[model samples]
Target: MLRIVLLFLALGWNPVAGAAEMGDDGLHKEDWFSITFRDVAEDIVAAKGEGKRLVIIFEQRGCIYCREMHEKLLADPEVRDFIKANFKVVQYNMFGDEEVTDLDGEMLTEKTAARKWGYVFTPTIVFLPEEAPQHVSVRDAAVATMPGAFGKWTFLNMFRWVHEKGYQKDEHFQTYHARVIQEMRAAGRLDAE
Candidate 1:
């Protein structure tokens, strides 16, 4: 256990404060929402034919916030189902050696894609049209890039906000968040196990 503690510290996992959620079926309760985590370029190429947008989440092992969101926040049944149904999910390590083709059709390493795409932090979720450039904003103009693990509500709200084009007028995420919260409450899905 001492070794594990030291490892977590080296990897930078802060102590989590929220209550861990339990699934109704007595499992950790991850949703069926799955994203592809490799060869993003390839996936984008495929999406061009199908006209699908992609949400890529950059995650590193041992990241405290990433663990919190994936383990605590996304453990909720609702969020999982929402993501699985809406996005093409992908998760990748920051310092990995996987190969991915770039938009230019150049073959490069995953690390190169991170640097080229300006992935500066752990748990950075990049939203882009499947065939769009990284700099081309999908729905959120200023913050097409999000860094770090946010609360469950905010994270989940992002999917709906951007998908529905709510960023056109709002300057910040709070308004959209408030609206989503109201909707969630209305549906009585906030406390969904």
Candidate 2:
């Protein structure tokens, strides 16, 4: 299948610069934290059982942002540490052969699942419970969706925003964004400020 070929191609790729391998803590280190996905459903189920959040990073073969997340953002030591401690990460080829049970109770191809969830772009990360309601289906977002690439500081702020359940209070990213910026200033990323 096309996806099979693409997966092989991705695995074969070398960044040329040979970025450091990220560890379980989401830190760029000398170990491999990247997992080759086998069974998504089972892994998510276990991850939830263990009280780990599920961060499903959906990406395509040719997406540069996806590569950056893999090579830069995710490869960063801080991010890697946070991810390892807080989440069970999974990667899927947007058009791969993986069959995911979407927000709705329908089983769909990874490609169709992405479309059904209405993510029309590459590198959408979905945060959700392990099992969604039967009626939710593949066509709807089963959980929270973050689209596009955000730099390190912004993404970390976003993580804190979610961690504090800020969205449930205001449902406004800008509100949380400002609050996080203030908090960051208090912590004295003065140079960043």
Candidate 3:
């Protein structure tokens, strides 16, 4: 028992090792998230130039669901790596005072922008297409919007679907997610539990 305990300690194992870092704004912060001017149009162009899709995530301080997502789903190495490779992520505080320039050329604070975008949840994620329509707000131009927290499989499948431009296909996200789940199960990558 003593030797086993010592071995475990030497391996530096900890279940909570993957917890996300908190920013001064009290929101979860990831290294992969871009530090941008919050100009939606410019950000979209930059993301496309990098061969990445643009993803804007809205989160607030002290949101338990956001914490759950950061720790449980986003913390998974596979998910994190996938997002980093394929997406340019930007974070906005749902109630913050930071200025944001909407795709429609409307300038507003982050809080007002969230309201205009109809994001009432703490962890609303908006995925944008490579080319946004002129004179349209983000709400009108977004290809997909994921509200609130979700399990790992659902979250990962959503990312995959958006990255693949599934919104242009006849198969819906729900169906795509189901198919991915089935494939994962068959591959023994998902636990029955």
Clashing pairs in 1: 33-84, 35-89, 35-90, 36-89, 36-90
Select the stronger candidate by lDDT from 1 and 2.
2
lDDT by residue (48-110, candidate 3, tens digit) is 999999999999999999998898778888888899899999999999999999999999999
Candidate order by TM-score, decreasing, is 3, 2, 1
In model 3, where do residues sit more than 4 Å from their true spots? 1-18
For residues 1-193, what per-residue lDDT tens digits would candidate 1 score against the true structure?
A: 9999889978978554233433332222133334343555556555445444566666665567776776766766667667655666555456666676554555566567778677868888876554545533222322356788777778877876766656566545677788777887998877642
Error of 2 at 9 (Å): 26
TM-score of every candidate: 0.65, 0.71, 0.90
lDDT (C-alpha, whole model) for all candidates: 0.61, 0.62, 0.91
**CA shift of 172, model 2, Å:** 2.5
- Estimate the overall C-alpha local distance difference test score of candidate 3: 0.91
The parts of candidate 1 lying over 4 Å away from their true place are 1-37, 45-52, 130-143, 167-172, 182-193
Q: Which runs in model 2 stand beyond 4 Å of their true positions?
A: 1-44, 138-141, 190-193
* Global fold similarity of model 1 (TM-score): 0.65
lDDT of 2 by residue, 55-98 (tens): 67777666777767767776677867776776776766677766
